[model samples]
Target chain A: MTRRLPDPRPQVEIVAGRAHVVGQQCAACGLRTTLVVSACPGCRGELAPVRFGPDGTVWGSTVIRVPVAGRTPPYCLAYVDLDGGPRVLVHVKASTEPVAVGTRVRLRGDSGGDLVVELVR
Target chain B: MSHQAAVLGVGTSSFGKQPEVPLAQLAWSAVQEALSDSGVDARGIEAAYVGSVLGPFGSAQRALQGLGIGRIPVITVENACASGTTAFHEACWAVREGRYETVLVLGQEHMSSRITGAIPPDLGDPEGRSGLALPGVYAMAASRYMARYGLTLRQLAQVSVKNHGHALGNSRAQYSGDYTVEEVLASPLIADPLTLLQCCPISDGAAALVVGRAAARRDAVRVRSCALRSGRAWGYRSEHAWGFEIVRETAEAAYAEAGLGASEADLFEVHDSFTIGEILSIEGLGLAAEGEGGRLTESGHTALGGPQPVNPSGGLLSRGHPLGCTGVAQLAEVTWQLRGQAGARQVEGARIGVVETMGGGVAGLDGNACVVAVLERP
Candidate 1:
């Protein structure tokens, strides 16, 4: 007999050339979050997988100048609040200028399977 | 029978980059000092609780090997940065429940020899894998706070200035200097809006406390309350910033347990691993209104001689943060301040002191863990 192993990639999928992150929504309370959990953290209700956003608004951002996690220095990290719901931490395309809070952004793709976002021109 | 817990003695190894000192030796020094201060022999310690984040396995046993206290039950705690105080909290409960009359709580970390740059987030953490470093998290908070509350860069740098200045009188501090806002801002940037001076340095040290029944020592600083809480799931709809609610809720719980308000505390030793951390902590601790911590700090209201001083022992920024060691060190500082033994940097007439330490970096949550403790001079 043969057995199948679960995919190790993040729950992000690309549809119609746009990135969408697979999250969860509470069946009982309608709460959404990117954290994979068996029960809703808020109400202890059942949760179902839900896809969130190709677009979002930058809640906060920072330019990391120190090396970390096998990555070189000078990168941007941001908390983007997806349009449908759920806030996710992702890499923002670094620019000469700092990413401002509340900047309109959209999912560009994923970096090594991790979500990445960019400013919406 | 229930008993009241009190800190019989507290001690700390010098806070700095001591790469030569082994973790066991670092812990031994603090343990020895605490034992001497409390006038308690090694054989008298009925139980031991140790906290360390990056230390080797069985660190508690290894550190206590030479002291002949190995036979007692040794529990090790690892709650990221809150490890020390969490151990202290556990020890307090053990004493309170009559599990042990006297117990030792020790926290030690030797990061200088192992880590060279910014401490990486856990490999298993989604945010850590997404390139979100610790400084980046605090910097993002600073950005959001600045945009929302009109906090200036100068106001943010003032946190570093005040903390560094406070460290001047702290003999155990790792780094101290008379720094200006301009000087702080001029330091090499670690994360946007957060310079090198704004971040705590990589340090190696340990701190220990002796906890006993309140009636055992008449001069002991009473452990009025020690409240520990884990973060809740936070999403975009969350009312406050990432770390705000957890700290607030934990502080509220601690204050309620102690039967007093934040105003009653004369001093505070909060987790200021970054400059922005201090501002957020002050607001969360109810020392200032939301969005008002910057103004309160800029006005010198949180300085050493201020009405309600914060981090009179220089805080993690200057006293140095050894992850697990920080919370224990904060407790020691508060104990000394409450007993009027904190010379030069003493908060005069400090009858009560509050200590808050937060450990974070798990994805999709406010924080990993936070501890809020209230101590009183009796």
Candidate 2:
């Protein structure tokens, strides 16, 4: 019998059945960041974990043709600005539809707990 | 009154593949050239600063060891691509502060052996997990630039055509040609709207500078100011964040230090690693008004011999983006232009010159690091 390997963990924690990306907000300076840090880069304020949008606007995006991290060619990537103030990087699903700036997108959780973005047609 | 620092000499190795030569030897070649150019012997060097990213850890010690420079205070800088100018900034401060009379700054990279399409990202960052890299980030910017300002693909290709044409006169540049805009557009696309010709090729090269106190040499170029800024990625709140804010702030600081404004610059050497990069950087640096960079280029305002020529050295697009070497190379080119030494591609009567170098990118940040400086002919 072959042992099952685990999927890669999500970059940010997600509550069960919730389709939102987690972010951290500085309690003092009100600065928000998608990446987790002990102290705020702005004012050295303490950070508290917060949940951001289930949707966002695609600020900028590209479909990489070269192989990246065992991922096949032609996978889409985007800098998605959440409905809230935070911005995060998301892997868009493979589709013929063009992903341009300002395109609306929704977040979905994969089996690995990673969030993938889908075009909200 | 503030102290002054001057660049006494500058040197650079041929910027292309040099796998047959060791990294230290490549650095020593540039070092020897700098020592000869400055007419200052190795004995005159009081301290050294080394800048590199992927090279060996103690590359400074190894390079100096190969050059037979006896013990002197050496510090290695690894501020991404800004490492070279970062070293130069530290050297200028030392000279101005009276800590060292003369210092050497060297930036070297060996991309021929260890680099390919895009640099791999650390998995610790979520963006890396999402497979976001340099090309993708810049591509996103290109897309936004196109959407926000109505910039066309043809207009962007013109930058490559112009820079490559300028490189024809530069014997040290890795790539040179008289390509047309159509040709640039026809090249294979690396990222959307950015073709092969539109992206800077990776190469192995080295650039060195000798900086000293005021009036150090007969033809030294005065270091008016050097300013650096790191990313406030987490704090920045904008969908259109293309790292321009950092460039703007850094440029403002440098101008304040130099007691001048963008209008005072006769020429510029910007971080044009990609076509859109030049467009965004020039605007951010205040060379052109916001959202007018592409229009300015289209109008031939940024070309050589224009009111204010930019990247007369062909920039990273044609000169090759050898990482650590790029920033210091900008200084060398600007120095030559200011001293009336840059032939063929020189911006005539260039008095005030600006050099901007930026590097490193993380998932949420605009840019990991940036360096900007102003120089005057002396």
B170-241 per-residue lDDT for model 2 (tens digits): 899999899999999999877776788999987888999998976677788999999999876642375344
Write the residue-wise lDDT of candidate 1 on B173-233 in tens digits: 9999999999999999999989999999999999999999889888899999999999998
TM-score of chain A of each: 0.86, 0.79
lDDT of 1 at B12: 92
Residue B114 Cα positional deviation in candidate 1, in Å, after optimal superposition? 2.5
Task: State which candidate has the highest DockQ.
Answer: 1
Error of 1 at B250 (Å): 0.7
Q: CA shift at A57, candidate 2, in angstroms?
A: 1.0
What DockQ does model 1 achieve? 0.51
Clashes per candidate (backbone, < 3 Å): 0, 0
Q: Each predicted complex: what DockQ?
A: 0.51, 0.42
Local distance difference test, each candidate:
0.89, 0.82
TM-score of the A chain in candidate 2: the value is 0.79
The Cα error of candidate 1 at residue B73, in Å, is: 0.5
Model 2, range A24-100, lDDT digits (tens) per residue? 78899787776756798678889998877778898877777655665666767777778866777777876522388
